[model samples]
Structures are given as C-alpha cells and as structure tokens.
Target: MPTREDPLVSFKFGLEIEGKLTGFFTQVSGIGSESEVIQHKVVNSETGETIMQQIPGRLTWTPVTLKRGVTSSMDIWEWRQQVVEGKIGEARTNCSIVAYAQDNTEIARWNFENAWPSKVVGPEMDAGSTNYMIEDVTIVHEGVERVS
Candidate 1:
C-alpha cells in the first residue's frame, strides 16, 4: 500500500517566461485547459429508445493572468507592445509555471507552448492612497502540459 501525504501549498510557486525569470508574482490565475464535446443521437431498434452519445471536439487553453508589484523591468510591457504592433509571431514564446517545495526545490512544472501576451494592464495611481503599484498581464497559449 502507498502512504498518503498532504498536497502542496499554492503560494510556493514561481513563473518563468521564455527562460527569463519573471520574479515574484502576487497572483497567478486562469491556468486551465478545456475541450468541447460533440454529441450524437442513437436509437434502439426494439425498445424504440433514443440515447445521446458524446465525442471529443476541439481543445482550448484559457488565458493565464499574472499579477505582481511594479518593477523597473519593462519586459512584460515590451512583449505586449509587440502584439499591438502586429508582430505576434515574433512575440510568441514558451512559459513555465513551476511548483516549489518547502526547501525551494522545483517539484513540478507546467509548460505552456506558443504563448504570447494578449493584454497588459498598468497599475492605477491614487494620490490619497499608499500601496504598492501592481501590474498585470494576460497570456494566451496554444496548449499546456505537465512536464514534471
């Protein structure tokens, strides 16, 4: 028999984009993939009953959103700018979301293929409030797979 263990915590993870360290991110969401289904009807000859059968259809990966406090680097913004300028092909790259253990060792990794920045949002400024400036970016990818 196998021994049971507790699942990994969510916060101890990291993000890497095209082999570049993305630094610390406050939030990472929308890491999902889904497939559509096609349905068909089948009829029973003797009982005169109908049944619906489903078949797998197209697959789609949801856009991933990454949020973090403002930094001096403009790498995320530069990637988005390329998209806005109709240079999508040059902007597409691979990304990895890695899970780290308590000892800071990489235990698992999810690799996203052909990813590109779809949108970028800047931090909001308020004169009366004091908070860390946060920026967010949305990334679209063709597929996502667990590599480890």
Candidate 2:
C-alpha cells in the first residue's frame, strides 16, 4: 500500500533561470496546454446521417507569467529586452520552477525548454498610495513537463 502525503504548498516555491535560483514571486500562472480541435463531417453507412467528429489538432502551450516585487535585479528586464531588440534567439533558455514542502524540501519541479520572455510589465506609480512595487513577466516556451 502506498502512503498518503499532504499536498505541497505553492506559496513556498522558487523560479530558476538558466539553472540558477532567480528570485521570489508573489504569483505564477498560465501553466497549461491545449490542443486545437478539428471537426470533420462523415456520413453514417446505414442511416446516411451526417455525423461530426472531433479530432485533436496542433498542441499549443500556454505562456507562463511570473509576478514579484520589483527589486534591484535587472535580469528579467534584460531578458525581455532581448525579445524587444529582435534578439529572441539569444533570449531562449531552459528554466524551472520548483515547489517545496513545509520544511523547504524539494517537492516538485517544472522544467520548461526554449523559454523566452514574451511580455514584461512594470508597476504602476501612485504618489499618494503605498503598495509594493510589482512587476510581471510572461514567458513562452516550446514545452514544459514536471519531473519529480
């Protein structure tokens, strides 16, 4: 019999860029993939009725977005600048997001390949209001998989 384990908390996770621990993020989303549905119509042999069948087409990966408090590091911005400057080929790199258990033991790791920042947004400014300066960067990748 297999022993049950509590679900790992996502709050304590880290993002690694090019195999190095980058920084802490408040939120990370868009970790998914979808297939394009292809429809085809066929005729029933006996009833001669038209029937539609759904077929899975090309697979598309969702862009992963990372959000965090703005810090002194300009790495994320520099990475995005590569895309903006038409140097995307140089921007592509393998990255990983690691989830940890309560005691900070590594629980799960999501590895992505050929990832490049597609979008990066800086925090909005308001003089009278006080809020943590946040920034978000969305990365598009060829594929992602969870390995251990």
Please write out the lDDT profile of model 2 over residues 1-148, one tens digit for every residue.
Answer: 9999986676566789889988878788888799999999999999999999999999999999888999999999988899999998899999998877667788889999999999999999889878999899998999999898
Which numbered prediction scores highest in lDDT against the true structure? 2
Single out the weakest 10-residue window by summed lDDT for candidate 2: 6-15
* TM-score between candidate 2 and the true structure: 0.89
Please list the residue runs of candidate 2 whose C-alpha ends up more than 4 Å from where it truly belongs after superposition: 1-5
Task: Give the total clashing residue pairs for model 1.
Answer: 0
Q: TM-score: which candidate is best?
A: 1
How does each model score on lDDT? 0.86, 0.89
Q: Could you tell me the TM-score of candidate 1?
A: 0.89
* Model 1 ranges off by over 4 Å: none
Q: Give the lDDT of residue 117 in candidate 2.
A: 92
